[model samples]
Target: MNRITTAIAVLVLSTAAGCGTSRSATGGAREGNGTVTGIITLADEVGPKTGDFCAGLDVRVTPTGAPEEALGNRTVRVSRGRCSYQIANLPSGGEQLAFTVKPSPAWQCGNGATPTLAPEPQALQLKDYQTETRDFRVSCTAPSAETSTSTSTP
Candidate 1:
């Protein structure tokens, strides 16, 4: 009797543990994909200083979410002060998309302080066959760090 009771309890527990709801809070494992595209400006005052805004600039895309399996980090080179980026074939899930822009030492792309992502990471829920648009900006002013006479070369 003891052995039978233990076996029944084990089975019941196992069955209960294995049970899962048919619906997911965020609508689990969906089909289809989505895309995100945008552009970034180097800045009004900084464009001329750099001569070529498209010369030395890069933008990176980072995805933060669960086992998306479709999302990944993407890096793009800015051209003529414009950044057109796209992230496609994404699984239906929650994602915090982030963008960061950096310029080469030769070319300055930020204000007196430093360059930063205009719009921080955004929380978005991607739907099947959906496309989203986001635009970024990079501006600048007189170099702050270089104001001093510290002409130290890296």
Candidate 2:
């Protein structure tokens, strides 16, 4: 072969070899691999004059259908009304998992009544090692049957 032709062939082969390898979450798996992380935020309420119940809330996560005895151990702090969490080492597939978070309880509303309760026990679904981030809103008002009695003389 001519020297020019040989040089061109070498360059082509070198470039092709480098192009094949790619960096992905699962080391370039067909479905891919990566970590999933998310943050939870709350929207301020303005109706009924209820106090901020979600501020400094505590969130708990537990794997459902695991076992009866293994409940309420893992917890995520949502202080300042925000929380962030992550799920790692996921495989490739359309798999779904359910998790629940118990937000810190609020005490009272503006009318000297019980504070409203937010939504509890949230569910999450994941697919094909998908890295997803989502937010949840709490809407349930605190039950009036329970009220706080804090008396202080001014």
Candidate 3:
């Protein structure tokens, strides 16, 4: 029964995703811009060490060649060590777009230690009428002694 219910829920979501391409009175879709869903995970090397804190990441998306007045909001915050970013109401013909990931201020090992961070920003282009997913690995350095040492006594 649970499996059946899960399957039904998935079907509904997929169906809605396929058909939800119109503007509405609510804040979902205002145009035919399709949705993009994905999970942002900690780089393999940066995980457990950094506690796999997803909230420590920042994301932003912007359409290229957009008029200054046409600027729109595309920033998303990671929740529960993951993120599901969706850029809606995007103009269909917009050729290029920008995606950026900025690690949060707390993305550290603590104790004034600066965790190694990704060297460069990850960017992605936009494709209309498509669902897209992209994964990025941020480079990071090992935590300093002060931050890496455990306080528990043996």
RMSD of each: 11.7, 10.4, 12.6
Please list the C-alpha lDDT of all candidates, in the order they appear.
0.55, 0.46, 0.52
* Predicted structure 1: lDDT: 0.55
Model 1 residue runs over 4 Å out of place are 1-32, 47-81, 93-112, 141-154
Comparing 2 and 3 on TM-score, the stronger one: 3
Please provide, for model 3 over 102-150, each residue's C-alpha lDDT reduced to its tens digit, 9 standing for 90 to 100: 6666554433444443434444444577656655555456555765757
TM-scores for candidates 1 onward, in order: 0.48, 0.38, 0.45
Best-matching candidate per TM-score: 1
Off by over 4 Å in 2: 1-36, 42-63, 67-81, 90-92, 105-122, 139-142, 145-154
What's the C-alpha lDDT at position 47 in model 3? 41
Cand. 1 TM to true fold: 0.48
Name the candidate, 1 or 3, with the larger TM-score value. Answer: 1
lDDT of 1 by residue, 33-71 (tens): 666667666565444443444545554444454333334
Per candidate, the number of residue pairs that clash is 3, 8, 3
Error of 2 at 22 (Å): 28
Model 1 RMSD vs true structure: 11.7
Question: TM-score rank, highest first?
Answer: 1, 3, 2
Candidate that beats the other on lDDT, 1 or 3, i.e. the better one: 1
